[model samples]
Target: MIRHLVLFKLNEGVSRDEERVRAGVRAFQALEGEIPELSFWECAWNITDRPIAYDFAVNSAVADTDALKRYLEHPAHQAAAAQWREFATWVIADYEF
Candidate 1:
């Protein structure tokens, strides 16, 4: 399986508690059932108080690279990412496990 992980840090003036951010987070959370290639999907707000911690995260798994590609290219994923781009910056990693 391919484990795809992403961490998002809100932009300089963005707040996690704000309505817009929460809505964007919910948009991503809703993708679990929308994308057929995803074998596992989890999205959450960061609870840690550390300065280095990201504001939000997504941990997902897919059958293989092809499935991972499908997940990334899915319309729902693209839309959610475009929305998130407005208020955050993110980093991602993918690996076989």
Candidate 2:
């Protein structure tokens, strides 16, 4: 299996409470059962107040690299990513397990 992790940092002056941000969060939260390649999915806001912590996180798993690629290229995933692009920057890591 492959693990796909993402951490998002809100842009300066952006607030999590904004309607756009909330919608983006909802989009991501909706991805679990929408994508067939996703075997697991978990997303949420950060609870800690530490400076180095990201504002949001997504932890997901797929069967293999091909499945991971399909997940990345899926239209729903693309739309959600585009939504985040307007208000935040993110980092991702993927590894086989």
Q: Identify the leading candidate in terms of TM-score.
A: 2
Q: List the residue pairs that clash in candidate 1.
A: none
Per-residue alpha-carbon lDDT of candidate 2 for residues 1-97, written as tens digits (9 for 90 to 100): 9999999999999999999999999999999799999999999999999999999999999999999999999999999999999999999999999
Per-model TM values vs. the true structure = 0.96, 0.98
- Candidate 1 has an lDDT of 0.94
Which candidate has the highest lDDT of all? 2
Which run of 10 residues does model 2 get worst, by summed lDDT? Answer: 88-97
What lDDT would each prediction earn against the true structure?
Answer: 0.94, 0.97
lDDT for each residue of candidate 1 in 49-84, tens digit (9 for 90 to 100): 898999899999999999999999999999999999
Model 1 residue runs over 4 Å out of place are: none
